[model samples]
Structure formats: C-alpha cells, structure tokens
Target: MHIHENRPGVLTALNQIFAEQGVNIAAQYLQTSARMGYVVIDIEADGDVAEKALLAMKAIPGTIRARLLY
Candidate 1:
C-alpha cells in the first residue's frame, strides 16, 4: 500500500487503523517532499481480512490511495 498525505499524524493514524484490523505491519518505507508525504507498508494479514484492511486504509483522511501489493 502507498499512502500520500501532507499533514502530520497520518502515519500514527494508519498504524492505529491497521491495529484495529488485526494487520501486522512487517515493514514500512516513508518519503516526504515539501508538499507531500508517501508511505509504503508491508503488512501481514489473512486473505479474509486483507481487503477489509485495505479499504479501511483508503478511507483514512489524507490517504491518496491504497491497494494490495501482491
């Protein structure tokens, strides 16, 4: 998943959401520019819950997009 934002606390918010969905974040990479922020999260979740988790992530404020990597 890739998250794009321009505000503070987006990462924290994302973590909380993942936790609520029982998704374990195995790895994360973040990049920021003067006008935007990008984050890639590698998660561990069962197939039954993965789609739900991704949709939840996309619903977050400031998240530009979310999708499965594999």
Candidate 2:
C-alpha cells in the first residue's frame, strides 16, 4: 500500500479493509507524508488468495498502490 496523496487516513482505512476481508497482519510498517510513502504488511494468507487480496487492495481508492513483498 501507498499513500492516496489526495486522501487521508491510511491506517484507519487499512484497518477497516483488513477487517472486512478477515486479513491477518503479522507485521506492518507504514509511513506517509502529504504526497506518498510505503506500507509493508506481513500477512498470513494463502498464496493465491493473498494475490487476489493484494489486487483488491489496489482497487481501493485510498490504497492507490498495493503489493505483496517477498
């Protein structure tokens, strides 16, 4: 995930998103400014399902960007 730039409330938005999908975040790091930043979430999810979830995250307006790190 990355900052939406125009949108605010990154953490709250993600927390709600995760709750909605029953995503379990093992670890996470987030830093954002007025423009952009990065979010890394270590999650417990099956491979294929996780990829699909990642795509869904990208589809969210405030997310702007989402990726599953190695």
Q: Write the per-residue lDDT of candidate 2 for residues 1-70, one digit (tens) a residue.
A: 5445545666666666667778888888877676766777778878876777776677666656677776
The 10 consecutive residues of candidate 2 with the worst lDDT sum are 1-10
Model 1: per-residue Cα lDDT over 1-70, one tens digit each: 6557778878888888789887788999988887778788888887778788777778888888878878
Q: C-alpha displacement of 49 in model 1, angstroms?
A: 1.6
- Winning candidate number (lDDT): 1
Winning model by TM-score: 1
Listed in order, each prediction's TM-score against the native is 0.84, 0.70
Q: What's the residue-level lDDT of 26 in candidate 2?
A: 89
Q: How does model 2 score by TM-score? A: 0.70
